[model samples]
Target: MPVNRRITLAARPVGHPQESDFALDEVDVSSPEAGEVLVRVLWTSVDPYQRGRMSEAKSYAPSLQVGDVITAQSVGHVVESNDRRFSVGDLAVGQLGWQEYATARAGTVRPVPEELDPQTLALHAVGMTGLTAYFGLFDVGKPRAGDTVVVSCAAGAVGQIAGQLAKIAGCRAVGIAGGPEKARDLIELYGYDAAIDYKNDGVAEALRGERVDVYFDNVGGEISQAVHRRLNLGARIVICGQVSQYNAERPELSFHPGLLIMFRARMEGFLVFDYAHRYDEAARKLAHWVASGKIRWREHVTDGLENAPRAFIGMLNGENRGKALVKVAERAE
Candidate 1:
């Protein structure tokens, strides 16, 4: 039997995931049982949602138990198979963990498009991150022509796609990011009409210049408060994420009931998993846009599995430029 390296949850974290919260170990590998396959991990996505999983707080996904492998979305190639549906060398994407290899049930793993670029397909503009942007913007935050749409965390994976989708819908798009460079990229690279550096400027004043009919909020706290104040009557706010307050000991702001009355606005939260049935539709549309050179994706990939913890921590701190991924193994050509 071969042995594989795995990273497991050493302890439940309080706020942000720490090095002490993870334990790296080498474990014996077992052959795939019936209807299962053994995969050599190629890439693993690190997302903000994982932080919520590290805590005991209730969420869409269950908290990781101590001593269990840290769960993550992984892209890999099958090295051995017990199911007839898959064979050796088949590329698949599924929920594996932070490990060099994994044994996944046949039903959970899906084959990746053979023609798609492996690296790009793993991180951005195609996978869960892209789907989140697609459904959230079109289905939830419906921006019509001439409507002003605002997105927070504008330079991130989902934000970049949502902003571009708003533009495609003929809306004037504005973005709010943490820094000047990201602000510039949101405008120049992602086609946002305007971008505000939230770290340096007054977010409310910057957004008030435009009639914001839709606000795609990724960062909550004061930023959400600012957007709430500037929302036009009947505006729709899509509560995507609250990255800013994810690490806080306690929520910084209480929900403002007054804004709901003053603007007659609607605020709704959505999870991408709810739209799983429409993933194919969203993928087709996103792929068409990518092929036409209409939408651009950015990724921050770290080189090794050893760096996964650091990469993930940095991503939560807004250090990554786009979707963050860790390369675990190279695929055979």
Candidate 2:
């Protein structure tokens, strides 16, 4: 019997997840049934949002129970199929969990176009990360030309795309990140017009010169509070992810609600699933930007499936530079 290696939640973590929270095991690979395909997983994503699913607390997405297979956006090639839409050797992506091989039923597995590079398209651009940035900025943020757009978590997956999208719309893209290096990448690598190192300087002080017209808040905390303080009248704040507080051991503090009234700005939180039907339209545009050299993509990959838990923890600590993912197996060429 072919064996499948996978990870599961061994225990619920109270604070930052450690290796003890995850358990790796091997099991028999199941064959696909009718309307399903057997996929040999190639790449799997490890996102900050996965941290939220670990707890029993309710979130927009369902919480994962202890001992449950850890789910992530996985890309793989079809090895056997009982579905008409997917033939052997077709590339597909879905929440195939952390297993080396996964069975994906129709509607669960989405086929990847043969022309698109599967490796580059795994979990970053053309996937949830890109879609999140696209919808968060365009739909929720509603940034305008000549607007001063500020993005937090500027070096991470969503923030990088959001900042670039802001610049593409003829806005001044400003970024605030944790480290000096990440701050530099926001400017030198991602094309942000201005970048702030929150670790070294006060984020509010750095942007005191201009009133921000749009704020893309990702790493919510003091950074978000500072940005809120600088919002211009009629500004929009897109609440994306709160990576800063995901691993907190205690209840985190919040900023004053009166700031929104004072600035006459609106703050809205969104989950990308709300606009899933319009993903194709955004993907086409993002793909064009990638092909035309407008958006520079990045992925920090950690080899081996067994290492995913630690890699995920590292990503939570802001160790990865860009989109954090794990390389589980090589895709069939």
Candidate 3:
């Protein structure tokens, strides 16, 4: 019997996570049965959303109990298959968890389309991360040409793409990132016309001159409070994520909604799954942008499955410049 190494929730954290909160263990993995396939996990995703999933309190998705393997979106090749749709060696993507191998139903894993450039594309630009940026920016924010689009967490995965997409739509892209270096990348690399270093300068002061028409918010907190006060008439605010307050030990203090009534703007929160029916359409457009060199993606990767916990913590700490992922194993050429 072969062993599969796994990362499981050992203890739930009161605030910021501890390394001891995770347990790495090895167990014998089951083979694929009829109508199933066994995936040799390659690349696994670590997102801020996982922090929400760790708590027992209910949200959009179910929470995980202690000792359960951490659930995650992963990409890998089929090592064994009992279903006709998935053949051995075919690359597939699914919520496979943090493990070396997993057996999933044929319907649970979707084969990555051939047109997608790289096998790892399942994790970032052409995947859900990109799609979140797509629907949040286009459908929610609804920016137009010459509109000023402001993005928070602008150096991270979705933020970087969101800023670029605004530029592609002929909008003035303004970014708010943590450091001077990330802020510089926002202007030089991500095609942002203006960039703000929230770590050094005042976010509200940085946008004093620019007319903010649409705001794509990722790390909501004081930054969001500042942006909401500067909204132009008919402005749209897309609430993506609130990473800044995700790990607080106590309940976070939220700002009053006086500005919403004052600005007469629209502020809406959305889950990417809400747009599942339109993913293919979004993917087609995003793929075109990537091939034409308009949208770009970067990955901050950890090398081993055993290190998955650290990778997750790093992402929550704002350590990644782009998408945060764990490389579980190498693909065979």
By TM-score, who's the top model here?
2
TM-score of each: 0.96, 0.97, 0.96
Worst 10 residues of 2 by lDDT: 113-122
Report the error of model 2 at residue 33, Å: 1.7
Tens digit of per-residue lDDT, candidate 3, span 123-195: 7788878889999999999999999999999998889999999998889999999888888888777888988
Better of 1 and 2 by TM-score: 2
Q: Write the per-residue lDDT of candidate 2 for residues 1-333, one digit (tens) a residue.
A: 489889999999989899999999988987888898999888999988899999877688899998888989998888999989988998888888887999878777777777776455747888889899999999999989999999988999899999999988999999988798898899888999999988898888898997899989898888887887788999998989888888886647656778878888788999998987897788889888887878887889999999999999999988999888899987656
Q: Which runs of model 3 end up more than 4 angstroms from their true locations?
A: none
lDDT per residue for candidate 1 within 1-333, as digits (tens), equals 678898888887777778887888998999999999999999998888778777777788888888888888899999999999899999888888899999999988778788776445745788888889888888898888999999988898889999999988999999999988899899889999999999999988887777679999988888888878788898998989988877777868735978878889888999998998888888888888887878887778998887888888889888998778888988888
Indicate the worst ten consecutive residues by lDDT in candidate 1: 115-124
CA lDDT scores, all candidates in order: 0.86, 0.87, 0.87
- Residue 147 miss distance in model 1 (angstroms): 1.3
